[model samples]
Target chain A: MRSTVREADRPWARQGAGQHEGRFALLLLLPAAVVVFGVVIWPVVRTLVVSLYDVDSAMPGSYPFVGLDNYVRVFQDDRFYTVLGHTMYFTLVSTFLELALGIAVALLLNAPLRARWLWRSIVVLPWALPTIVNGALWRWIYNGQYGALNGLLDTLGISETPTQWLGEPFLALNMVIIADVWKNTSIVVFFILAGLQTIPSDLYEAARVDGAGPWRAFWRLTIPMLAPSIAVVLILRTIEAFKVFDIIYVMTGGGPASGTQTIAFYTYLQAFSNQLFGYGAALAYLIVLAVFALAMVYLRILKQNQLAGVE
Target chain B: MKPTSPSSGSIAGIIAPRPTRRGLLVGGSALGLSGLLVACGVGGGGGKKGGGGSGSGSIRALFMQQAGYSEENIQEMTAAFMKANSGIKVTADFVSYEALHDKTVAAAPAGTYDVVLIDVIWPAEFGTKNIVADVTDRWPDDWKQQMLGGAVTTPQYDGKFYGVPWILDTKYLFYNTAQLEKAKVDAAELDTWDGVLTAARALKESGVKYPLIWSWQQAEALICDYTQLLGAFGGTFLDDAGQPAFNQGGGVAALEFMRQTIVDGLTNPASTQSLEEDVRRVFSSGQASIALNWTYMYGLANDPKESQIPGDVAVLQTPAGPVGRPGVNGSMALALTATSENQDAGWKYIEYLTSQPVQDKYALSSLPVWESSYDDPKVVETNPAVVPQAKKQLGDMILRPQVASYNAMSQVLQAEIQKALLGDKEPQQALDDAASEAAKLLES
Candidate 1:
C-alpha cells in the first residue's frame, strides 16, 4: 500500500514538472504569436467578421448585421467571377513561365563561368527595383510611338508600324505579364540557384562516371533533389501573382473595357472606388480560400515527392 | 507517444491519473485566448483617435495645388486671409487636383476638413449626401448677384445652394494654323464636325498620319467630348423627373458621330488611351492638325519651350452641332463643411479667394467666376485666349447631370461607349446596356 501511494505521488510530481516545462515553452512563443496575431491574424478575422455585415467606413457607427448577404451577393456578381478568372489565368500562365525561365537561368548560372558573381548580381537588378517604378519604366518602354521597344523593333525592321502594346485589349495582359516576369523571375532564379547549391556535386560525378548524359544526369539527380525548393517557390509565386494590383492599376487601370481587371483590382475598386466595403471583404475572402486550396495542393505534391525519395 | 488509459474505480477504492493532456489543452487554449485579447486591445487602441475632440478656433481649408502653382501661393493666401480676420487662424492643406477630390470624398463625412475646394461635378453628389453645408441662408444677396449666371446655378440641389463656384473652365478646339494652311483648308469653314472631318481628310491626304487629335480615352475626356456633341444635338441627360434620358435620340446620334470619326481614320486608335497631357503632346509636337481640349492649352501651345507649333495655334469653340456648339462647364467650387465649427471664417476665406482683385492676380492660372473679373483689364491681358472664348461660352456652358450618383452613372455610360468605340459592341447595344446598368445603379 505504501509503494502504490508513492507511485501515485510520483506521476503527480512528473506532471507538475511537465506543466512547468510547457509553461516555459509557451512563454517563449507568446511574444512572437502576439505580434503576428496583432498585425495579421486580427485584421483577417475582423475582415471576415465585417464581410458578414453591411458596413461603411464613412458612417462608422451605422453598420447593421446582414449575415452572409454580402457573400451571397459576391457569388452572384458577374464582375467577381470575371475578375477571379483573370486572376487565376494570370497566376497559372505567369508562374509556369517564371518557373521555366528561373530554372533555366539557375542551371546556366550553376555552370562553370567567368565573372560569376558579377553576372549573378546583374541578373538580380530587376528584382531589386520597386514594383511601381518597374511598372512606370515598362509603361514608357511599351509606348506605341517613341517607346524604346518600338524604336528597337523599327530599327530591326521587325514591322513597318509600331504596336499599341498597352491600348489593345488582347495584348495588354501579355504586356503586363512580361513586365511582371522581368521583375520577378530573378527572385525565383535566386531560390532555384540556392536549391541547386544544396545538391551534392559528387552525385553528378557518379552519374557521369556511369555513362549518363547531361540531360539524364539533370533529370535523375538535379531535378529530384530540387523538388522541395521548387514547391516553395511555386506556392509563393502563385500567392503573389493572385494578389497582383499595383502594376495593373498603374498601367492600364483595368481599362479598354475591363480586360485587365483581376480579383485584387476588383476588390480595390469595390472598397475604395465604389465604397462597397462589405462586397470587397467578401471578394477578399474568396481569394484567400482559392490561395489556400492551391497551397494545399502543392503541399500534397511535396509530400508525395518526399515519400518517393524515402522509398 | 503512448495512449493514456483512464482509471476504473469502485465506490470506495479508486485511483486517477495526472490528466496531463487535459491540463495541456486548457493551458494551450488560455494562451490562444490571451493572444486574442491582446489583438482585440490593439485594434481597440486605434479607434481612440477617431473620437478625439473636433478641431476648433482654426479653420482648415483643403485646396488643390494646380500644376503651375507653388507652395508660396498657399502661404500667401493663408497669410492674407488670416491677416484680414484677426480672430481666426487659417490652415490650408494643398494636394494635387486628383488627390484633392479623392481625399474630400473620403474625409468630408468624417469631418476632417472645415472647408474644401470641390470640383464642380462633386457638389451634385456631396451636397445630396449632406457632406457640404447648405449656404443659401448664409450667402449675401449682393455676392450671389455678382456671380455668373451659370456659376450660381451649378451648386443648387433640391432648390438649395450647397457651394459657390469660384473657378470656371470650358472646352475649346485648338487648331494648328500652320497645319490648316499646309492642307489648304480654310480655318473659318472648320466650324462643324462635318467641316472639321472634311478638313481632316484633306490634311490626311496631304501626308498627315493623324489629322485630328483629341483625348477621347479616359472617362472624363470622353464625357467632355460627348457633352460638346450632345449639346450640339440638343441632348439632355435628365428628364423632368431627374431620370437619365441619354440612351435615345441625340445621345445615340452623338455616339454614332464619335464612332464615325474613329472609323473614318481621322482619330488614332491610341486616342482611346490618351489623357490630357498626351493630347497636349500630340498638338504641341505638330503631329496633330486639330485638337479639342480646354482653353488653358492656349498658353501651353504658344509657349516655345513646350510647344513646337508656337505662334501657329489658335483657340475656338468646339465646332457647332445641329442644335448648337454646346460647351461642357468644368469648374472648381468652394464649400464649407456641415461639421465646420468656423463656418464664418471658412466663408470669409472663400470670399477673399474669389474677390475680383485677387481673381485678377490668379487669372493666368485660373478662370475666375466673378463677372467683374471677365472685364478686368489685368485679367483680360493675362488670359486673353481664354477670356474671349470663355466669356462667349459662359452663357452656353452646360453642366453635366447633377445627380447624386453622377460618377457611377458616368462611368457606366463611358465604359459602354468605350466598348462601342473599340468595336466590342454595337452602338445601340452599348447604349441599351449602359442605360440598363445605370438604371440598376440609380435604383440602388
Candidate 2:
C-alpha cells in the first residue's frame, strides 16, 4: 500500500487524487486555451507559413513556394526603408514625449487638490475617446483652410497666414506624433499616479530629516520607487507606438508623398490594397522579431529594479 | 499553457511517456498546429470555384457610401428590387469609397458578397484576378448601344464585360459667377485652360486669394484630375506598345502647367491636400472663384442650406487645353463577385437597378448612365445646371490606363505628383520618376 502511494509521486502517474486536481484545472482552462490557440497561436503560425510562399490574391490558387525570398524582398524594396525610417522616428519621438508629459501630469494629479475627481475626469477625456474619433478630430484641427489651430493662432496675432500643417512629409509625421502623445499620455499618467500612491510618506519625511529638498527627495526617492511602473508603461507604449496604423489611416492615409507611412500601415497597403499577402506576412514577422528584442530589454530593466528594491 | 515544473514540462512528458500533464498539452497543440499548416498548404494549392447556388436564395451586396448614391437611396432601391422579384431577398452593405476596394478584395475568398459596386478603374484588376465574373456573354447587345459611349466602357476589360455601368459621372469646371463678375473676368474665357489661367490672375488681383481649387489630394481623385489634364494636353497613359508614355511630350507639359498654377498662387496651396468635397466647400464659400468637381457638387453648391453663395454657382464642361478638352471618366458599375454562390439572382438584382426607369427616378441623387435619359425632360429638370454640361462632357472622357496593376501604379504617381506640386521636385523629374516606377509594375 505504501509503494502504491509512492508511485503517485511520479509526475503525471494518474493513480491518485492529485491527477484529478490536475485534470480539473485543465478542464477549467480549456476555454481560455482554445481562445488563445485559435486566435493567437494559429494565426501567427499560419502567417509564418504564408511568408514562405508567393501569394498575390486573397482567393486561393496555386502559388509557388519561395522560402525566404519574400523576406529578402522586404529588405531590398526602397519603400520599405523609407517607411521603416518614418516608423522609427514616430515611435521614438512619441514614446519619449509621452513619458515626459505623463510623469509631469501624474505628479500633478497625485497632489492633494480640490475637486480632484473633476480634474482627473477632464484630463481623461482625450484618452477615453476612440482612436478613430481622436484622429478625425485632429485632422479637422489641422485642416489647411479652416482648421481651429490656425484660427486660434490668428486670434492671438501669432500668424498672418493659415499654415498647411499636413502638406509637408516630415512636418506631417511630427504633427501626428503630437496628436498621439496628447491622447496616450493619459494612460501613462494613470499608471504613474497608481505607482505614486504605493509610496509611503516616511520616505519623504526621512529625506527631509537628511537635509534634502523636495526636488532632491523626488529624484532620490519617488523616481527610484517608480522604476517598475515606468518600465511597464515604457514597454506598453513602445510596442504600441511601433504598431501605429489606424490614426494615420484616418488622418493622413499615408499621404503627402507617403510621408506618414508606418510599418503597419505599409503592411496593410501591401496585403490588402496591393494584394501582396506573402510580402505583408514577412513584414509582420520582422515586426514581431523587433518587438521581441525590445521586450527583452524592458524585462531586464524590470528585473534589475526588482533586485534593487529587494536589496 | 500554465507554467509548471520544468522537470514535468510538456516536452519531457511527451518524450518520457508523459511525465507531466504539460506533455499532453504540448503534444495536443503540436498536432493541431500541424493539421492547420497542412490545411493552409492545401489552400495555397490550385483550387476550384465554389460559386454555384440555386438562383433563388437571399444574396448579399456591397455598395459605396456618401458618393454616387447615398446609403438610403441604395437601400430604397434594393427594397424596390426585392419587392419586384419576390423570390429573392437582398442584403446591402455600404462602405466609404476610400474603403470600397480593399473591403471587396478582402471579402472575395469568403464569398461574403454576391455583388459589389466597383469603380471604373477596377475592371482590369478584378477581371484578371478572377475576383469579379466576366459577364460579356450575358450582356445584352442592344444595351451597349443604349448606354452612353463613356458609360459603356466603364467595366470593359480586354474585350470582356466585367460589369454593368450604374453611376455615371465626371469632373466639370464649376465657377462662382459672383466672384468672376466681381473680378471682371468673362465666364466665356473659362472654356480654355489658357484663358482660365488669365481669368484666375484677374480674380486674384480682385482680392480673391486663390481662384482655382482642385481635387488633388493623394488619392484616386488626384489621378482622375490628372487624367483629365493629361487628355486635354493630348497625352496617352501608355503608348501603342503599352510602355510608359506619360513621361514624354504632352504629359510633361500638362504637369508643368499644373506646377505653374501653384507658383502663381492662382491655385490654392491647400489644393495639394484637398479632395472633391473640400473643393466644393471652398468654391461655395467664395474663398475660391473657380474649381473642378463632380456633378453632385453642383447640386450641393447651389443649395442655400449648404452653400453661402448658392445663386452664384455655375457649371461648365472641362476647359480645353492646347489640344481638346476631355473630362476624366469617374464612373462606377455593378458586378457579380466571382465567388458569389447565387449569380443568377445577383444578375437579376443588378439588371433592375440599372434599368432606365429606376435610374431616372434617382436622377436627383446621381446622374443616369443611359444616353436617352439626357434627352428626357424630367431628368434634365432634376439638375438643370449640370445636365447640359454632362451632355457635352460625358461624350468625351479619358480613362486611367486599363491595367491589372493600375492601383499600385496610381499610388506611385500620386506620391510623385505630390512631390512636384509641393515644390520638392520638378514636374519633369517627377513624371520621369513615376514612369520608371510604372515600368517595373507593368513588368510584374
Candidate 3:
C-alpha cells in the first residue's frame, strides 16, 4: 500500500489511474453511444430537417425548403384535429382505468396471500406478451361473425344477435381500449406493487389508531405514499398511449371509418401510405413536443417531491 | 436536516440534482434546434433516380404473397427463369398485398429491388414519381395487340407504358351451386343486378341468413368492389375536364343499391369489416351463398381442403347494372425499378415471368393475360369452371381512376362508403362528401 498507495494520495499518480479507468469505461460505453447516435439522434435530427422541406418521395431528389409551413398546416388540418381528439380520449380513459385497476390489483397482490409468487407471476403474463400479439388475439376475439366474443355471447345466451365488435367507429375504439387496458394494466400493477411494499405498515396502523377507516386510510396515507410511483407510471403510459400504433394496426387498420386512427397511425398514412413525408415529419415533431410537455409535468412533480424531502 | 451543496459537480448534487424546468426545457430545445440545423441536407443527395445497367447480373424482385401468383408458383417460375438465363441470377421477396406498395417505395431510394410487381392502380403513382422505369420503347408493339384489352391497358399511364402486364384479373361472381339449387334460383337469373337481388332474396328465404357477402372493408379492396359497381351503374370517376363526377347520378345509385342490400339483410353486416380473404372464407364455409372474388379464389374455393362446398362452387361474370357489366380490373404487372442498377437483367426476368408459356403453366393459380392463351385447350383444361367466365369477363374489365393521388382518393372514398354501408350517412351524402374530399386531393 505504501509503494502503490502513494498513487491514492499523490496527485500525478491519482490522475494517471483515473485517466486509465476513464478511458476503459469510455471504451465500454462507445458501442451504446454509437447506437443511440445512429438510431435515435440521427433520425430525430433528420426528421426535424425533413419537416422543413416539401420532400414528397422517399427517393433522394431536389426538394423545396418550406420552413415552418408544415407545422402551420398541422393546425389547419381537419383530419388532424379529428385524430387528435381520438388520441386524447384514448389516453385519458385508458390511463385512468389502468391506474384505478392497477392500484386495486397491486394492493391485493401486496397483501399477505396464498401463492404470492404464483399470483405475481400470473399478473405479469399479459405484459410478457408483445402488444402486437395481444392486438391480434383481441382482433380475432372481436371478429363480428366468427369471433370468439360472439361465440361466447351466444353460448352464454346473453345476446342472440351477433354484435359487430370492430365494425362501428366508436364501438371499435372502445373495444380497442379494453384490449389495451387488459394487456398494459399488468405493468402498472407491478409498478404500484413495488410502491406499495415501500409503504410502512406503521402508517396504516397509526391511521387506524386515529379512527381512520380503511377507505380513509387508503385515501389519506396509501395514495399520498404512492404519488411518485403514480407519476412515473402516468408519464410512461401517457406517452405510449399517445403514440399507440401497432395494436391499432393489427386490430383495426384504422378503419370502420377511421374510428381508431391515432395521430401516430395518421402520420404513418401520411408518410408511408400517402407519401407525404414532409407533413408526416411535422406531425411527428408535434408528438415529441406533446410527450415533452408531459415529461415536464412529471419532472415538476419529481422536483416537488425532492424539495419536500419525500424521496 | 442537511445543508445542501448547490454545485452540480459535487457528489451529493450529482446524485439527486434539482434541475429547474426552464433550464432543462431550454437546454433540450436548443440541442434539438442545433442538431436540426446542423443535420439539414444530410438525407438529400440531389442524385438522378432512374437508369439501366449491363443486361446481365444478379437481380431482386418483390411480389405480393397474398394474391395473384402464389409464392410457390413464383419460386418455381424464378427457378425456370434463372435456368434459362444463366447470366442473370434472381432473388424474389414476397410481402402481403397490403405491404407491397410501401415496401417498393421504401426500397426505391436504396435500389433494393431490381424488379417489382405493381398493382393496376399504382402505374400512375409509380410512373409519375419515377419509382418504376418507363419501358414504353422496350415493350414490343405486337405484345400489346396479343394481350387482352384490359391487360394491355394495365401498365399505361398518360400514354406511357410503365411495365409489362402479367397477372390478368377481374372479380367474378362466385356462388354456392348446391345452395342456389336448393333455393330454386336459376344461374341465368344471376345475370343482372336486379335478377341477382331476386336470387339473393330467394336464397335468404331458403334459410341463408345473408345470401350475399362482399369484400367491403375500409380498404382498397372496398374500392375495387365499388369500382366494379360504379362502372356497371354508368358512373365515371372524372368528367372531361377532370372534375369529380362520382357524386352525381350513377355513383349515388350504386352506393344506394349497396346500402339497400344491407338494409334488407341480404348482405352480411360483417361485409363492412371483411376483405377478399374474409369473403372467401365466409363463402367457403357455406355461411354466404354469393360473393365476388378474383380468379385465384375459384381454385381455392373449389379445393376440398379449403372449402366445405368444394364440389358445389360455381362462377359467373359480375351481374350487370342499368348500364353494363364490367368487373373491376384487379390485374397487376411486372416492372423494372427505376433505381435498379441491373434493370436490363430485371426486364429480362420480367419478360420470362410474363411469358405466355410461363403464364399458361400457372394457369391454375392465375389465368393468362395473353389473348390467344384463353383459347388454348391446355389453359382451359386447367380450370374448366373459371375459364369460361374469364373469357367473357376479362374483356370487360373496368379500371379505377388512374391518378397520382389515387391512394389518397381511394382512402377518402373508402371511409365515406363505409359510412353509407354502416347506415351512418345516406348514400348520396356520403358520395358527396367523398367527392369533395377527393377533389381537394386531386387538385393538390
RMSD of each: 7.2, 4.4, 3.6
Per-residue lDDT, model 1, residue A89, is 82
Chain A superposition TM-score per model: 0.89, 0.92, 0.91
Q: TM-score of model 1 relative to the true fold? A: 0.85
TM-score-better candidate, 1 vs 3: 3
TM-score, per-candidate, Cα-based: 0.85, 0.93, 0.92
Question: Over the stretch B1-444, how does candidate 2's per-residue lDDT look in tens digits?
Answer: 122343755676655763358877886777676657745663565443645477788999999875567788899999999888899999999987889999999999888899999999999999988899999988999999999999999999999999999999998999999888888999999999999999999999999998889978888988888888999999889999998999887888888899899999999988888888789888888899999888788878888998999899998999999888999999999999998889999999999999999999888778999989999999999888888989999999998999988988999999999999888999989999999999999998
Task: Please list the C-alpha lDDT of all candidates, in the order they appear.
Answer: 0.77, 0.89, 0.89
Best by DockQ: 3
What is the per-residue lDDT of model 2 for residues A49-146, given as tens digits with 9 covering 90 to 100? 77888888877876778989999999999999999999989989999999999999999999998999998998899899999999999999999889
Q: For candidate 1, list the clashing residue pairs, or say none.
A: none
Across residues B300-319, which tens digit of lDDT does each residue of candidate 1 receive?
78999989999999888778
Candidate 2 local Cα displacement, residue A39, angstroms: 0.7
lDDT of 3 by residue, A1-311 (tens): 35445555766655467789989998997898678777887788888888988878777766788999999999998899999999999999999999999999999999899999999999999999999899989988998888999999899999979999998999999999999999999999999999999988987898799999999888777887787788889889999999999999888889988888999999998888888889999999999999899789876875566446432
lDDT of 3 at A300: 89
